[model samples]
Target: MGFFDNLLLNLDASVTGLFGQWNIWTSLLATALVGFLTYQVATRQDPDTHPFLLARQAQGTAVRQPGESPVYRSQAAPHGMLLNAGLNVKDPGASKWSRGRDGDLRDVWRQAVAGVQEPGPTKGAKGRILTVLGAEKIVEHNLDDITRQINLIGQHIADQGGNRVAIYLPNSVELLATLFACAFYNLTAVILPFDQPDDAVISMLRRSATDTVVTAPGSFPFDAVVKNYPSLRQLIWVVDEGSKHMDWNEVPQGTGGSVNVSTWQDIVNDAPLDAGKTLPPLEGQKEPRDVTVFWQSKPGQQEEMVRFTAGNFVSAIAAQIFAIPTSQRMGPSDLFLPADSLANSHTLVLTLAALFSNASVAFNSVASQADDLATATGGIAPTILVATPAALLKLHTESKPALSSFIGSKLHWLQTRSLTQKGMMPAAGGLLSSYYDRTVRPALGTTTTTTTPNKKKLRLIVTAERVGADTPKLSSAVLSDLRALTGARIMYALTAAKVAGAVTQTNFYDYRVFDDKCSHFGPPLTSTEVLFRDTEQYKTSDNISQGEIIVRGPCVAGMEAALGVAGKMREDNTLAYV
Candidate 1:
């Protein structure tokens, strides 16, 4: 009818005659082919190491010397397009089922940082990879700093003759240093939930027989928790953001037992740099190091101590990294924010997951407050946001008041549909998105534009352990709500005690598949197999599914205990909760 319409018709006719019809089915087939090729490229792996490739290089080149290693431009190895990490050689000690890095967790870090050094205080140093949010200064801890602190901490705890140490601090840079230190040595690290009251902390400490407590100043019931646990003989305190300090001697000593208190600052100041020098003499003892124990409690039951071996830990980290989309892997370039308590399974696992991929992790302490987790995350947008459903629910509740009126939004949606059909604008930059984001979004307090080149897109990774039958954090509602508000992809995860990591996670691209209130957790992670067993105990866990989810895999603990979770596998290879 118009000049442009006539021109478009002519072009379409020419294209059809020259090539082929661009129908819906043809477009879908092209999309599938492109996706398959992209997947192959993204998941590519180099089979042969540079040394091996050079060894097989042509003999006439500069590497002509016999048995000489250095060479260039060699033929590629077979199946060199797989996504892999860590040492490629076969480990004699690694089990066929394991297929994991079989040594200390620190080894994983070594692999992650190899040849990826950044220039800093030390020449080409891998400096301070952690960021503690809400701190007065930019807090960061590098591998060397972490190692030095570990040496000092290992000796201090060893002096007290205690191997099991409980960390009862909020998400901080110090927490990361301490956990890795305990794992490097053979000490068992117990992550105590910082939000618990004194009674719960003391009860869990006594149950775990934790002999050492590491926490920051003025943490919840610090004096009360350490005093009640008689097995705990030492209290290692760390410094807060400000110069504010506390004296352990000033507080009343607990009559329950005689406990010696020390500060992390004092220990680092007093201990020598070579604290781990003596470690070489005791290296070949064949003792299983890095035993990390996570405590999960039921309302009327004793706290469950889930023990994770180094193999289990490595497997869990690997599975978490692979569970992410190949394009959105939490790699070295990403900044991950853990808004929930690091003690929670999801936060803790994803924190280390980011680390294993050489990505820096950022911690938000405001989220640990009584309320305002989502509010605290107002301006700060990290590439990956790992949060609990409770935190996301708080955000959702706070965002509801900021949404546009019902009728106005309906009109805007209709307008967007028509405009998109006319090819005038992108769906993302439609009238509704621009209007609500500009007018109502000031409530969120984000000043920068979402399209800024430097600003990373947000990917919300939610764990539902905090959302129960009585909780307000409905999975389906929270997922859809937060996605609509922030335009971010939300991936949900389910934690099982026996499973070292999340048993299942929603696919990276799958969003809001269920209109019903109940939401699905997607599918089991790689190297994991899951089946449903009929059980009434976990029936209350979900409404649409009734069974105890049984998972046995490389990262799964050997146990048959009912995890009190109900789920079913879908034909699309995802798990949906009723």
Candidate 2:
């Protein structure tokens, strides 16, 4: 008792002596420190997603193949539950209690044209489609105008007995309208890459057995196309306003009258003004025709024609729509732009999702090219952007020199800290933002300009890695820097040729930097599940399973596909390429 009391007395004496030595300034300093620490603790926020959820992103089946790991699925659809199949299309006058039909591509257009129908009395307005050239807005078309074009072009093709139509134009309104027209008119649409050579285009058309082709005037050798493609019976030239004066309907002399040629503008002009105000009624059509994609695994390789059914496309579109969190899902107010080529399955599916959600869309011909992103997106602001890894890498490399400066370095460090350490995105547009823009952005030539009110609206960037394509690898550090620089959350996806959308995509809230090589692709999409096939070198093990990626689900083109790339599941259950 005596010893304990003495120790307590000594401690009290020391505390009193320490307090006695403090002047008013020292007492104020101590109080301020305590108050600041309390405020920090009180105001700290939890991460957007719980760590527990990240730790177990996918669920594994109990039974497994002898040499393979248990099949893994997104927590959204686990084990025995069916993966997302198709859009639950509810038609007008249908019983609300009945399960909706698995809709096709035609339903996608119908939903877009019908606009948003809220529960309230007021009806939502339809979204517009804009065509942009370099930073300039060339033209804006309303939903009615697009529908009119679809009707005219689709009727013209059907009248010509066109069965398979190849769309060979750039990212233009014509390409989009034609795709939808094919859906409504029951024609198979073959989407060909715009950057292909004339010979490659001819090869793809020959392989696809394309009966009709829609291409830009003067872009390809008309003689070569008509001569090479014997099955091609019709050629529809999409002429720009600048070249509308020129006659593009002239067939090559040797091809004779075997092939019918027409101009898109003439077709529209000859139609009644009131045409295409309503979608063509589906009398006996139960589903839309298949849409084929020309998949080029690598440069100089023969393209493989991958056919996707209406169910396949709709399933992927629906899955992508629901992938984002509810709070961050796209809506009628959002503006979406595909900076990458829509020929990419990932980008195509996302664009369709945007249209289904009634969001405005813009197209640029320079998509997938080495163009300045700032200049490409100058005229309008996009809330969501889908780009390729190369485009983003260009932006990252260009900003490096600017970020190397003292002010840029400090701001970048602070913002990165906020993103990685604090699980928060630093707020944009303040004195610090203005300072960085003035000092840093100017140094980045032609890629970014001074911060604009519209520029700050970019919230999400969706990019992906083709499993076997020879593209630059996007490291996690680069992605983190991109997030800090652009102030947008990035979702990196792993896409395979046979998959409709993607095998797996990172969560929008996943901002951790795992390594300098490749970022982790979160979990399998709701429409698909992932598994690993054992190889001689890598096998399924207790600690970690690494092998070839095998995917199976409704989103897959053939219901199952084996990705040739090697991958492993991380401790956090995220998918990463080996």
Candidate 3:
């Protein structure tokens, strides 16, 4: 007591001496000065934190600041702008997606890749670019390497008279290179889903009129499948080593030896670096790289080939970029993991979105089950995840409860809800992350039922493509449980089987307003235009609530994604599922 009292007496004396001479007004003024200086430093260092992003900072809409992230928050009364609150469709001539080079996906992709060339952080190959998974070692591809491969592969297609090339392999860096090569050479890429049965694949091959099939070294019974379809003139095996691949001599004989087997290495390695020189310039074509992605209307039914043009791809990338909050925007430093098969529209587009923004992409198995989801999340620990509602639901149901129902309710209202109403402090980003600084790891034998900790926490990129919005269980509400488990901010979308890509997506920052109970697929993407007509999609008797939804934009259907899909629209400009 004697020692503690002496210490306290000394501390009080020091505090009194320091502030006693300063009046209350002076102390308050000094505090304000310090706070102002702190804010100034933070904004200057991180431009995204500045209040006006869609306004003044949008000066270079496509450009990202070096070192600092583009995602930001509001200092006072903070909220994101209604990117499409009102359909600014007064002038049909004013469509930005249709303005340049027809706003083709090819051009947009080119621009997005170019944007990354700036002196800053990046991921991928050759020069710390994209990273490919499934290899015994790490593989990266730079823009130059990708371009070279594209030109050579494009040249190969031109020489083979192969107008349509089908890729039937798991996610890898080579698949991306091939798709870009198709875009580069003005050839149509036919992508076959990797998960389909051999019979389904063979049927789709014949139906697609595919001349060549690209696949991994040991993927399926390539010989048996291709034998059924004589139109499949070639089977190109993907091998990291040219010498190790089964040579043409070892390949199975197709009908009349019409099928020529080659390795991806042989095609690219043998071509000259100046292969693109002889190819026709993209400007000369009336239409550019057309892609045919097969969608099975049902599991056992015949596949429908939905064609997408470069322009549609471009619009998709641009609109997707606009949809991501600057705070959550994909950057060069962030690693992207496409857990779902790249065959899915959402997965492919998001991959391109990351590359277009100079971010890195990693591969993981198609997350169709809870185990797969857990493995993918834990293996990659991705910051951005592109998955379907089914996978998300699986993870939610499989997860060990962090809080009991009653305690969860208490935290939801008392903690998560309150902080969300007041914008998330940039400093609080870690609070939702596994690296949360405030909480200490509990020792063994401790039973902290209220705290559910995820060592690999990640945000979500989900789609409502096949979901029935009116169905309570399968609707966006399914993701509510998942969000609470991982503190992941989900950006859900209204994607359709027939649609070229995303029709509507939630604003990343706007998740808090509409919590976990109901489905909230945000407004239409910037490049898409939507309108509704009376249809069965309108479950509600209210005249304004339901109707068949129609969209016209670069991300629509048709070769250039200039076509539209049928759906229902709400009065608030959101798309209702058909």
On lDDT, the candidate that comes out on top is 2
Q: What ranking emerges by TM-score with the best candidate at the front?
A: 2, 1, 3
Which TM-score value belongs to model 1?
0.70
lDDT by residue for model 1 over 1-578, one digit each (tens)? Answer: 99999999999999888566668888899899999999778745433123232222211122222222111111211122221222222243555666544444665545444423324333332312545344232355656666677767776787778788888887776777678667666688888777666687788788778888888767657556645555768787787646435564344644524677778887887776665532323235345564445544456454566676666666667677776657566665566777767776556767777776666666666655434554545545566776666666766766665556675456444433322222122134656567756644323324243421125556445555432323343556556556656556677776766666676676554443345565766555653555556664433222223355666565655623345556554434355563
Off by over 4 Å in 2: 1-17, 23-32, 120-123, 255-257, 429-456
- Among the numbered candidates, top TM-score falls to 2
Candidate with more favorable, higher TM-score: 1 or 2? 2
Which stretch of 10 consecutive residues in model 2 shows the poorest summed lDDT?
444-453
Any residue pairs clashing in model 1, and if so which? Answer: 44-81, 44-82, 45-80, 45-81, 45-82, 128-141, 128-142, 522-575, 544-578
Q: Which stretches of candidate 1 lie over 4 Å from their true place?
A: 1-104, 111-137, 220-227, 241-246, 249-257, 273-287, 290-302, 369-371, 406-436, 440-454, 465-478, 536-546, 559-561
Sum up the clashes in candidate 3.
Answer: 22
> Global lDDT of each model?
0.57, 0.82, 0.55
lDDT of 2 by residue, 456-572 (tens): 377898998987787777998999999888878899999988899989998778888775488888899999899999988889887776799999989888899999888888877
**Candidate 2 global lDDT:** 0.82
TM agreement with the true structure for every prediction:
0.70, 0.93, 0.69
- Which residue pairs of candidate 2 clash? none
